[model samples]
Target: AAEHLAATRAGRRAPHRVAVAGSTYSVFPVRAGARTPQAVGVSREVRETVLSDWLLVVEADAGDWAEERLDLLYGVTQLIAVERDRRDAARTVRRRLAQEVLELVQTGAAPAEIAARLRVAAPVLLPGLGAAPHWQVVVARVEWEDGTAETGPVAQSLLEEILVDPHATGPEHSDRIAVAHTGDEAVALVPLPAVSTEHDGSETGVLADALLESVREPLSAGLDGDGRVTLGVSAAVHSAEGLRGA
Candidate 1:
């Protein structure tokens, strides 16, 4: 299997690839030892350096290898770190934007101002969201065994996971979903394409179902018997008045 994978990826081999359920990772040998072999995985715990020439994980049987593997491991580690950092930075920007919106809503800021903020933050926080012809809100709550999941970043984490599907739109619509966390509950602001009045609005139900179906199982895992999760889907709002209602 390992040889096949290496052959498939342009003759580049990762001698000791670790498998973790749905994910597979590559580790390259760094140094040779009497018994143990020094190697490094594609992952690194240090966020500051983000990449390292040193080995990440030392295994019991690393064969003698040169710096060639070390260079490959370094490049892979850097790529992983860059992706992770991009995701983290995007999430932080979204959270800050959400907080700003919440405050503006409290301070009686004009809808135009709020909309401007959203437009600025949307693409940066949730990529692939173009001009929104229509939008909807999704509200959800999760009750955990110790209630920890409901209180902290877990709610935001769960919410992001639920709304991660960018293509969760109707056949007639050309838009995607953008989600953000508020407080104990997370809210999704989904965009829609132009719809004819002749089309039944029930198409939104399909989206809601998709959201529910994707989250039900993973949510069940994150939650215990003490953990309870409930969600409400607001009617699709084509206008500003409808958004206010949601």
Candidate 2:
């Protein structure tokens, strides 16, 4: 299977079936690893592309393996490809929202305009979170050893990865974070539940600390030894006017 993966990376596109330990497995090139747990699956060339080398292998009964099941697996893989494309397209729109909102705030756009944009962006960025949610601005920077590599997209990708919570039920539920890249920095716009009238936004400071704490280890490892990631989290802001200061 490893040899087949090597061949695939070397530009070979043919699928292969291999017998291992009395069982046969079907292998196919994938754009990314299967999110769901399967009897067999593997991913190689993780950083090669947005969709890297994903090897999907399915276990087969000794003599029960049939063309019908093989065809079913291929059909499922095609459905996964479509879902991946949809997810990528949706992410692009979310990133664009973040970028446009950031630009509006930085350029001192009218608060009404910013608020309007937020209204439009709420459904996409916050999903089921709510219509009027408090927002936090998290700024992250990646410095590489060579200092020549582009950091915006790298930071953007890392931000998205870090923001996902394992306990979340679905992609939309876990995707409360949206990131936009400006210059060499990636800024994440995180939505939180609105504060009660009795409390101020200071509670969000705790949330900010927790965000950093939760991601510190994984992010450090992802940056490796040659790069460093620095994060700055702002206090929660409930209004467009406060977003700039946040």
Candidate 3:
């Protein structure tokens, strides 16, 4: 399918451009045999074209402005490429970790085995060996009013958007957090420094609130009835053994 699209673009004489956003791509398909400006109903040189099949003719004063906008569009295209690559890498890591963790929980793997898997999947996101780490788990509930098959893709897309900044509710900081969706729920594992205090109730509440608030509206479009998502945040576990209990 992609090869066919590439061939179509390659056959065109007019400069073709493509822009990507997340998993979707917007492509400008140049009309076949459109070699010059006269073929596309333009008096002056055509500087830019849009997905709508309209040519942006270059004018005297607007040429520079049009060129600048095209440059910005190119930058946006680059950003989209980077974002797609980052998401792909992140998904791969998360899938591997989830599978390893499941094996550890179900088959009772040794701590060393689990740690080895962690190192392979997520070295930077998870703190290295020795001291115990804190963990949080989240589950998503998918609800559709009419119950269409498109709901799944919609939910998946929204989950990706929420993972943009897994931590942080406000616009201040975008905490680098890892995210993975399991079945109908997106299981988000938040790692923090080991906290073993009784007065950490406020901190727990804040974290829970942030997670719920950030995911609420983004997942609302596909939900209906009394359906609402509630995240199950496990208490700070010292080891992989505790993940089994949660």
Candidate number of the best TM-score: 2
lDDT of 3 at 195: 55
In candidate 3, how many Å is residue 135 off? Answer: 1.8
Return the lDDT, model 3, position 24: 29
Off by over 4 Å in 3: 1-78, 106-122, 127-130, 145-176, 195-206, 221-230
Model 3, 1-246: lDDT tens digits are 232233232343323333334332333223433343234324421211110122222222222345456444444444554655565566665555655565565588887776665545444454342334555554444543344332332333344445454344533221224445444555555555455343544225225567677655533322323234445656655566666676
Q: In candidate 1, what are the lDDT values of residues 144-237, reduced to their tens digit?
A: 5554333434454455545554453543131134445655666656554344343655335336677777656544433423456677777766
Which residue pairs in candidate 1 collide?
40-56
The TM-scores, one per candidate, come to 0.52, 0.61, 0.49
Candidates sorted by lDDT, best first: 2, 1, 3
Per-residue error for 47 in candidate 3, Å, reads 36
Per-residue lDDT over 1-246 for candidate 2, one digit per residue giving the tens place of the 0 to 100 score:
454444443444335566888877756544433423241233533222221233467675313446565556666766776776776677887888898999999899999999998887887765664448788888878777778767787678767765665555635633567789987788888877685442644335336577788866544444445567788888788999999898
What is the lDDT for 79 in model 1? 62
Query: Alpha-carbon error at 205 in model 1, in Å?
Result: 8.7
lDDT of candidate model 3 versus the reference: 0.43
Each prediction's RMSD over C-alphas, in Å, is 10.7, 8.0, 12.6
